[model samples]
Target: MPKDARNQSPELDPVIHPINRLRICATLYSAGATDDRQMKYSTLAELTGLPADTLSKQLKHLEGCGYISRAREYGSTRAKDTVWVTLTEAGAQAYVQHVEALKAMTEGL
Candidate 1:
């Protein structure tokens, strides 16, 4: 457990602390463990119940932190382009650790 500035308790991961980010992480963490580890951007947006723009912004943050990878594939036509996202190994570990931290925080309460 990592301490915050006051060193009172384990600090929650800022990256995954937001509700939307936590939802995204949990979704990706479960899916990544399956045979099909990749998901379409649209599918993820649907799963997270977030608008396209919001999802894009959140995804950019996660990608910036090396938690996930985004790949854009273009079809023969311009409108056929599709984006796919997958969790990196680091992301999996982070998700597990975050879940454990959450559990610890609630254990004694």
Candidate 2:
């Protein structure tokens, strides 16, 4: 492998390795490809096809790892409230590095 590819050989991130967490990170990363974007909680739930509780649990784990951040916006009615999720800078870097590492590991296979 080239030096650059070798340099990319970091371990797959444990925090984002789980299938659900990987899906969440991938969606968030692609959604914000052009800019630092935030996705609504409901939208994520729909995309992931995960039950609310399960998604919440996965998100909580990411947040605890400093890989994601969440904010709540309140409207006049409780039903109008929105929760937004964004991948943090550190999170983005970690995700990219993990992908690179995967690529590196598979280069000669």
Candidate 3:
């Protein structure tokens, strides 16, 4: 077995793996759908306290996993386009896992 691997014990909580992904998913989870509440790139960066480049990489990863949807909305004229972020169905589930991961990482020592 590798130094770090899934625990065979069913007693242990089946969460807390992939801490980085959990953090990313947690941030995305807080940002609801555009229809519910549009989330801007800057806002996400501010809320997560992550740099734009890091956020961009995370966004691309999440989008590839079918967890989040990123859209560049442009107005008719020439103007700064808006970047919209929304959590997909998979994202919602991943968010739940992320929460569970936190609990597992910090529950009862």
Q: How do the candidates rank by TM-score, highest first?
A: 2, 1, 3
Q: Which residue pairs collide in model 1, if any?
A: none
Estimate every model's Cα lDDT from 0 to 1.
0.80, 0.86, 0.64
Model 1: residues with Cα > 4 Å off, grouped in runs: 1-10, 33-36
Off by over 4 Å in 3: 1-21, 34-37, 76-79
TM-score of each: 0.83, 0.84, 0.66
What value of lDDT does candidate 1 attain over all alpha carbons? 0.80
Which portions of model 2 show Cα errors greater than 4 Å? 1-8, 33-35
Candidate 1 per-residue lDDT over residues 21-95, each given as its tens digit: 888888887776322468988888888899998888988998899888888899888688998888888877777
lDDT of 2 by residue, 1-109 (tens): 7878646556889999899998998888888821367899999989879899999999999999989999899988989999999999988998888788777778842
Worst 10 residues of 3 by lDDT: 8-17
**Higher-ranked by TM-score: 1 or 3:** 1
Compare candidates 2 and 3 on lDDT and give the better one.
2
Candidate 1 local lDDT, residue 30: 71
The backbone clash count of each candidate, in order, is 0, 0, 0
Error of 3 at 73 (Å): 0.9
